[model samples]
Target: DTAVSQTPKYLVTQMGNDKSIKCEQNLGHDTMYWYKQDSKKFLKIMFSYNNKELIINETVPNRFSPKSPDKAHLNLHINSLELGDSAVYFCASSQDPSGRPPYNEQFFGPGTRLTVL
Candidate 1:
């Protein structure tokens, strides 16, 4: 099986609807994360679940919430979605944080495109 995978590759909804994006990673050794890629191709981490704990990136807005049903599953819920919230969400997994490029290497999932109208 692949290291990471996500569901619902396309999501289109109105501004006020609530939605959830699911992500699963064959994660271990404290290295799995969620990131958002905007239309501009800027990538930013939204959350990281490492060692069975959930860590949300401080830069992410409160509307974006990461729910970890377990150590290996990381999901996202967006409340009161807005037009600006549209983006491609990706889930990724790695082996560890060794402060090197190899350790930082991540196997990414097929992204979910969420378009809020």
Candidate 2:
């Protein structure tokens, strides 16, 4: 089984539409993250949730929101999607970095490619 997985591997939508991507991890990691990869393939961390609390929130537009109901799931919702929202959204999970050895590795799921027209 995949350690991390995402639904709707591809998403196509129009401008001004709202869409959501679901993600889940079964590795028992305490931290999950949402990342966006631009057309140039530059990946940026959009949100990070650890132990049911949000610990890192980048300067993303208000239109994008990350919700975590528990430690194993982190969902991304985009409201009034814009053309710039077209990108590959990735879900990743990692063990708490505060541990002894400071685990810095993240396991990524098969990304969801979002296209906006």
Candidate 3:
């Protein structure tokens, strides 16, 4: 059983198009994050959610939005996508850092590759 899963593993679309990637975690984690890996393979955190509340928002553009309807799910919606948006997006989950462990290793999902032309 996959601990974390993302839909539309491969997405190809034209510029200005809107797309969404859905993510879910069954590990019963309270924290989830969205990371983007560019063609250069530089992974950067885009957003983070803890217990259904937005905890971290990086320097991502307003065109990109992340929604967490519940602690188990985190979704990314991109509007007016551009060529620069082409990259691999990853969804990860981990126990809340405030807990006993102080730090928990994140469980990553199979990345979703988005290509904008």
- Number of the predicted model whose lDDT against the real structure is largest: 3
User: What are the clashing pairs of model 1?
Assistant: none
Q: Provide TM-scores for the models.
A: 0.88, 0.95, 0.95
Identify the runs in model 3 with alpha carbons over 4 angstroms from their true place.
99-102
lDDT of 2 by residue, 4-32 (tens): 99988999999999999999999999999
Tens digits of per-residue lDDT, candidate 3, 20-106, equal 999999999999999999989999999999999998899999999999999999999999999999999999999984535655788
Q: After superposition, how far is residue 33 of candidate 1 from its true place, in Å?
A: 1.2
lDDT of candidate 1 at residue 47, scale 0 to 100: 82
Q: Going through the candidates in order, what is the number of backbone clashes in each?
A: 0, 0, 0
Total clashing pairs in model 1: 0
